[model samples]
Target chain A: MSRRILNLILGCASVCVGLTPMRAQEFKLFERTVQVHGFASQGFIYTNDNNWLTMNTSQGSAAFTDFGLNMSTQITDKFRIGAQGYDRDLGQLGQYHPSLDWAVADYRFKSWFGIRGGKVKTTLGLFTDTQDLDFLHQFALLPQSVYPTDLRDATLAHVGGDIYGNILLQHHLGDLAYTVYAGHRSDSKYSGYSYFLTKYGVTSSSFAGLQYGSDLRWSTPLKGLLIGASRMNEEITDNGNLSLGPGIDFTSYSAVSRADWTNQFYGEYVIRKLQVDSEYRRYLHDQIVSPDSLETISDVRGWYISGCYRITKRLALGSYYSRYSITSVAGGAAAPFFPDQTDTSLPANHVYDKVISGRVDLNKFWSAKVEGHFMNGYGNSSFPDGFYPLANPGGFKPNTNALVLKTSVNF
Target chain B: MKNLRLLPLVAFLVLLAPVRARAAQVKIIANPSVSTDAISGRELKSVFLEEKNSLSDGSHVEPVLLKSGPVHESFLRQYLSRTDDDLRNYYRVLVFTGRGSMPKELGSDAEVVAYVAGRKGAIGYVSAEAGVDGVKTLAITDGRSPVERRVITRIEPEYPETLKRLNIGGIVRLQVTIAPKGNVENVQLLGGNPILGESAVAAVKQWVYATAPSRTRIEVSVPFNPQP
Candidate 1:
């Protein structure tokens, strides 16, 4: 493994120098502002007895890959159109093929109001828009607690429109951005979301429904300080990922709030070297499976704090502490095959993930990173229609460790 | 017949000479379609850097730049407050983030001036002595305070031959204190090469403006371009 890692580093460095990156080829098309950009990334993950993100992680897997090509054109000073095609193969999830990630025709009437229609990126938190932009993050993965990788498509974007605008509060010396969007999102049947369900005999389940949400961000007078809140309501119908034995159905609503602060303590030539980011996300779930037969309510919450410091112009070091817990789960007793259905204190139901990462810029468009995780619990279990491959039986408490190496380039 | 053969060569030199180290004066000019004739230096800076689309008067604007030249260098340093490489990197990040797009870059003062003159809402800068046939020259002053009135005529600084040959192009900065009566009281070099610094200082010393009671200190950048 060490030899492979060394070879990967050497090969990418050699290719990066020879690569003719398209990052700087931006020019007007037909005398209009049209810019094209794209990026690709690959990763290898190895874990010790933790069947998460993929099957049989005890050995290792290189099934994580992401690619995207995007272009945006400014038709006028106030009107713009942009779209991106995305593809990913995350172990047993994602189609491993291209899809219309987002395509929008955006029109800004003024500084105070704008309208965006078409497939739009979800307004979740600070990380929503740039989550797929690997080069933007110093960590191999953003905190899964706040940004679960498995929930990408379900939470990635909406197929509708959004009305967004900014409001200025002169006396307070701060600006507020508000966005309201309504649309529907789908959960892939082949994804882990469905895999977990199909394993329990749920052959037919639809996680698509009308979801509407709003996100608000307030920029305080302090230059780098911002506070944001996002609220969303989703009415979904699923069979509890269970068989036709009185199939289950339910709806869910969630709200996420976060704060982001960035400071420039060093390096102004290009990259601003140091940053600290933190976010807290909580979701409330209410499921009335089988109509009057059963009712369930629960709350899941998580938060994380991470800091990145650039030691040099080309090297960056980062560390983060993330914790997720199923604070409470009730009424699942009505659903078929649900054990410990009335309680949330079940073992392996929570997890504390600590990570350390190092990234090196091979060149202007290529970068590589290595990340290690120390886990204290197997709480990532979400077997019944969940992404994680852990099924905690006998209240097993397992500790695991994992390492990953990733390389990416964008232009 | 003998003189006729040399006519084209002489005319070519006259145009090519300014692209070299002969830059001395620069005039901020705008297309005829632009409705705003008076704009603050700060507002002008914002438009060219792709920060804002409209001037304070609500008129839209398009910023055109000389690809590489002493005047462009000086304009970026004094107005936009960034180095050449820094500006390019800035645009790259903007394009990458979808915040802004890179402005158009033309080759010479004549080209920029002609473009500005022909294109609606277009604005650019050229050698002050360069003929601006169809464009309108904007009035700018080092003083934003209540002290100095607007500038009527401006002078451009000569490009340093040594700096040009060495290809060490950048914006040279200076701090000028305007007297209450609009006379240039003092000029202090803030940043950039000393050779280019001297030329910039000499030209700014002769600038005249309307008068007020208190003096104003204006920080300016004089740029040197070595690329054709």
Candidate 2:
């Protein structure tokens, strides 16, 4: 990756020329306060041909990275609590381990009621609970047709409980924010769908699921608009094995999925230093597979539209136009046990792309970005949306053009 | 075409030079135990957007900030419409969503009139040539014009049969607060499609307005038309 992007641009120019001036950190403990936050990022992908997500980015992958850390406290004035942990690798997906990513405990009790419980974080649309708060975004990637990032742990947090609130619409007509959750996700056999199911020789081991959801939003009185919607439901299962060829035998396979669901719909609009966003999602699933149950049903669909401006105060600019698709509808009893659920008549069943980004900042908690993609389709490879077929074992290509370089930091 | 008639005098001298360099003389001090000397620009944008901590003569308030000058950019663009990186990303999304904290900025207007004159339910702003002697300068009143509460009655909302059978319509904002003796004492939902914002907050909680002089937060919209 160009010598890992020149050693991450000389380690972000010697930490932006030996930086100084930072914030976000607090402490007090029993006297309340607590705080503390953290973030880190790095990326450098290049492509001219194929090899994307499973990263080799056509021989130029800087094995993206990630980092996080959090802490919080309120301890009264309506109780509070928090936690975070996170880590990433991205090339073959989160192989660096370190999970946790949320801990919750919240309480609230007014501003229209509240409640929360462990693991939380899963609002679903509009950057799904601030997708790892990447310095609150300007995009380095977010709209791989709706925040994909290799299905960031299949919907990031959820180990149970939430109730949320924020109502206040009387005569001014503006304010409403709900939540309602349920949980128990689990994934991560080294994610990215267990490394794209080892290109069909399967081998997952377990996956787990049974989510639930709701989200609502609406902070509209026209000033800096916002709108939201989400709805989810899952059941999942996975298990693993299947191989039996040129190997010491294997074969157990499983799939399950008791009628999945998803819906999403978003919008945002800001009017100073410009900003705009849009989203749409769908998802339907319905699995059954196994030694012979069959049944399938897929549907997926994604959408996007983006914009960013902040022209100055350390530059900013963005663009987007993503799209994704997946069909299948039980391809004749699951097309002989899934071939990435093909049939959308080629172009590997859809993906569109068309990015363009730029960000700078370099202080106030650093930032740096440069994106450009053009992509066109390579979708259906077991939907992580970023094409994979075992990271392209040299077999499909319709269009590709990429170049990314990221850098981040948070305080 | 004669430079399109000097394009309307060069767009009115480029929007009158940023509205005369962002006019905003500032001054709205408070803290003499804040029992009012007059306030209201929507309660100083709900006490600097901590969304109300009191005032309307019930006193209690705190708000203080300045950390950036030009009267903290004209009191965050004339009463918190915000900007200063949108009020520091709205207080970093209220301190990363734990909802609120980080207010009390300070750094001149004589350190915000010496921390809103020794804090006591604070409140601040200065620069109409600073020197506010021991606080309490208030007096504003730009109620952001909504032509004094009209609509004395209006209801309308009821479209949700599975979102009008899935064709889903739009326009559902609501933010009513009225009650100075004109009903609608609350009704949030300020955008659309939360099942048409719970049917526009149940028909704007039984509409009725015009009786002002105090409570009044108006903003309504509710149009759901799945064609014919």
lDDT of 1 at A188: 64
What's the number of clashes in each of the models? 9, 23
For model 2, how does the per-residue alpha-carbon lDDT over A1-411 read when each residue is reduced to its tens digit? 454564466456535632766677788877776878666777778999988887888878877777776788766545668776887777878756788777788776554667888887788887776675666788888887667788777786788988877665665667778888998988888887777877877888888888988989898888889898998898989989988578568979998887888898898998988888998998887887777567677787889889999888998999989888787644345466555465654577788888989899876777778999897878764455777887787777888999988877766
Model 1: pairs clashing at backbone N, Cα or C within 3 Å: A350-A379, B24-B156, B25-B128, B25-B156, B26-B128, B70-B225, B73-B223, B74-B223, B78-B221
**TM-score top scorer:** 1
Given candidate 2, what's the lDDT at residue A267?
88
- Reported per model, the fraction of native interface contacts reproduced equals 0.07, 0.03
* Candidate 1 per-residue C-alpha lDDT over A1-411 given as tens digits, one digit per residue, 9 for 90 to 100: 553454355446534632655443466788875677777777787877556564345567666777776778888877778777887777667746578888888876655577888888877777766777777678888877777776676567888888887665555465677888888776666556566554444553556666678888876766446777887777655543244345545333221112111111111112245667778877666655553245545456668888888888689899999876664343444445443332334445666789999999776677789999887665543322122543322233367788888887776
Docking class of 2: incorrect
DockQ per model, Cα:
0.14, 0.03
lDDT, candidate 2, B1-228, per-residue tens: 866765675555445333333454566787799876656565677668765555545566768888886778867886778878777766665555444556767787888888788877788887655567888776553344333565678887788674465465655546677777788888887444565678779887988877876786655545576765
Instruction: Score candidate 1 by DockQ.
Output: 0.14
Query: Which candidate has the highest lDDT of all?
Result: 2
